[model samples]
Target: MTNSAKPRARAADKRRRLATEAARVLHEQGVERTTLADIARAADVPVGNVYYYFKTKDELVLAALSEHSAHLDELTGRLDQLPDPHDRLKALIEAWISQRETAARYGCPTGTLAVELDKRADGILDTEAGTAIRRLLQWAEEQFRALGLPDPDDLALTLVSGYQGMSLLTNALRDPDIMTRQGAHLLRWLDSLKDTDPAA
Candidate 1:
């Protein structure tokens, strides 16, 4: 490869590794505790290499949030294949619980980042994490729409906010039981919407 190609090759490699390291650190240590040095350490690169890819800590945090968003998108795709709205909703909640459990095993970065980011006024909080949350909310709204719920967007936001709050509580409790206890209430709410058209 030419010298020019070498730089491109290195750039691609750094981007790939940085993304991977960001996910790991975000999942393991949360955003506040996650540093470029920490990501570099996880990626086995010099700290300077991190700076080479990300000019600011927020950039890396955004990257981590993007990675997490991509992950949830992938899950959404799987749930999309189910034929029944009820089944899809069940699967969605189950997946959420599973995700939380895995995060717990990895130390719950989503919960950590949400709390830390909530305190800041940065735009990336919306561009990064908020966008991902909206994607899921939109999907849930679609599910409600399919079930003949009126105001699917409102209902979906309710579900989304409820889950976000529930996940925070679950993280605080460090127990999956919270999900088990609350899952039925959410399911009933979704089910209730199916009995009539939105206008009805």
Candidate 2:
């Protein structure tokens, strides 16, 4: 409501929009093929304005990485709301199922981006580049721990790996239904773990 606060809010909104668009573009085009102009066009901001917010392509990409991390956090935070850890874990697989089409088209947003960054010699890969999936894995680990599973760490690895692996296969085969089937399979596995006691 205040005059100064209004401008600050507007600036923050503008930057968030820019970063989100950049992330979408990078997801569609991969990191090396995408340009600031491509991102600016997607965001409906001028290329010159992009330079005003980010001095280099790498800076913009890092902003996109932040955008992805924020998205991952929001997703896991929602999973945290479920009353049952088994439900929460199953919901994680559901989230991936919901985006199966997009994965079939562009791959898993977090996984593909992390893979691209890892393969790149560009320094953006060094700076919080793969944290989105890493953070997701950590979140899953927490959920497994909450479930009192004997092998929380190993279970978390299975969950995250299944997601990434299915994402890759779905994308490679252009078969969105692969994720649907994978979700069903993971749900059954989670059910089998519901009664496990970590201390036993």
Candidate 3:
């Protein structure tokens, strides 16, 4: 029993390591450029081992995309700390921009992969990524509604679009200034809303 369990444990560990390395490679080089061999080298595993866990590159890419959802959870936790709903929105926006500043080369993996999958009409990963994004937007909308904001659903969707658009621009421009300016602008816009609303 102990010997049998050892192999299973090792296989689980190998899968975990491969998944982590795949995510890092996908984030750095994207799904198109990152190859299975590249992932194997980064993962410090044999190429055959990578294949043992994933039959094709698509599988690895999808797994990495799923792992990336954890990033959204982290953002949600950070946004939840703010007491005011307006501040929560601002904090969420600013924190995301700040994160993009650090993760510039990788861009937003969720958005990037979703866009790529859409072009190919790869329905499975595309649907998974879209679901994660929609969940985030829904959460933001609920926060806005809690603050009694008008058209919270529309505003939340708009904000999500703006955030992704800025991330793409920041990557193309390679300028932190754009992120800084855009983040401040978002905060200012929220401030204006707060000024008008008594509940805020």
The TM-score that candidate 3 achieves is 0.88
Scored against the true structure, residue 180 in model 2 reaches a CA lDDT of 94
Clashing pairs in 3: none
Rank all candidate structures by their TM-score, best first, as comma-separated numbers. Answer: 2, 3, 1
lDDT (C-alpha, whole model) for all candidates = 0.75, 0.85, 0.79
Q: In candidate 1, how many Å is residue 112 off?
A: 4.1
lDDT of 3 by residue, 1-200 (tens): 59999999988888888888888788778778889999989988899888889999989987786677776787787778878777778878778777766446656777777777787764787787687789889988988788787898987887888778777777777776677777777778777777877584
What candidate 1 gets wrong by more than 4 Å, as runs, is 1-10, 103-112, 195-200
lDDT of 2 by residue, 29-51 (tens): 99889988899999888788888
lDDT of 1 by residue, 126-155 (tens): 456666776788888888788776688998
TM-score of each: 0.81, 0.92, 0.88
lDDT, candidate 3, at 143: 84
lDDT computed for candidate 2: 0.85
- Backbone collision count in every prediction? 1, 0, 0
- After superposition on all C-alphas, the RMSD of every candidate to the true structure, in Å, is 3.2, 2.0, 2.2
